[model samples]
Target: MGRRTPSAYEGKGYLQVKASNGKCLTVPYDNGPAPPAGTQLFWWDCETRWFCASQLWNVVPVQVGTADANRTAYRFVNHWTGLRLSLGPATAGESGGRVTQDTCPK
Candidate 1:
């Protein structure tokens, strides 16, 4: 099992995913309507932007395989709505669709 460095945002209530180019994974405020579940998550080119509730995420640890107990990954759950992030069937094609939130699959 591999270990990762502790993030500065750890235990800060919200997890911010930043891209190599300095952009952040953001859920826009003006997402047409209220309730951010169906809103598409995208990268925003901003350094000092206020993160709204929709942009906040809860890290959910998920264990994979039985090889090592420490080997695990994470699922991002929206803070506003308790939905897990997923690539829907519509986005499975080569074209790829926007990242949306959905019910967690068992």
Candidate 2:
């Protein structure tokens, strides 16, 4: 029998992210609808495709399919600004090996 899977957007979706300019960004993606309230977001790059939030912050590492219970130290970058907020010390996780092709910057 196949193994049961969990929802990808569970618990981590909808995070209220703040930018370097003190402008809060409303993330509504499947990974995160909006970042958690009061989460600090540092501008890693204005063109990179990913960001890293605080390490202690619990977030779902967004992947293609099969939602898992793996919490990593990285938050997917915002698509609009093309900047990702670093979450942890930048450790290599399972989803880190996977590659996602996007036409956007960062």
Candidate 3:
């Protein structure tokens, strides 16, 4: 779900999240719905020139059960794909990541 223009990714409020290892989170594919679930994710260098969808992530606050304390839990959703970052294919819920983009539960 990559856009032709970089309007959504430009200006303030957009951040390229990187890890301690110096690699930034990347989506790996650009074509709409091209990379199906189980597409291995990598922390590649961010595409600063054009600002790819895979480079930006949004930390969404989700509602969880009140087991002991009711606190907000967060899910990382890709700007373009609108998918969540899952642990891997085996447990891909909304289901994305280790980088599989599967439909997850509310």
Top lDDT hit: 3
Candidate order, lDDT descending = 3, 1, 2
Q: Which stretch of 10 consecutive residues in model 2 shows the poorest summed lDDT?
A: 1-10
The whole-model C-alpha lDDT of candidate 3 against the native structure comes to: 0.63
lDDT of 1 by residue, 27-99 (tens): 6656555444566777765434454556567788888777655677888876666777777566656465777
Better of 1 and 3 by lDDT: 3
Per-residue lDDT over 4-71 for candidate 2, one digit per residue giving the tens place of the 0 to 100 score: 11233235442434455543333223454444422344322222133322211232364343466544
- Point out where model 2 deviates above 4 Å: 1-12, 18-71, 86-106
For each candidate in turn, the TM-score is 0.60, 0.21, 0.65
Question: Which run of 10 residues does model 1 get worst, by summed lDDT?
Answer: 1-10
Q: Count the backbone clashes (under 3 Å) in each candidate.
A: 0, 20, 9
Q: What is the lDDT of residue 69 in candidate 3?
A: 73
Give all candidates' CA lDDT scores.
0.62, 0.34, 0.63
- lDDT by residue (1-106, candidate 3, tens digit) is 2212246555544456677666676777756664655566777865656777777766677878788877789776777766766667465554342654444467
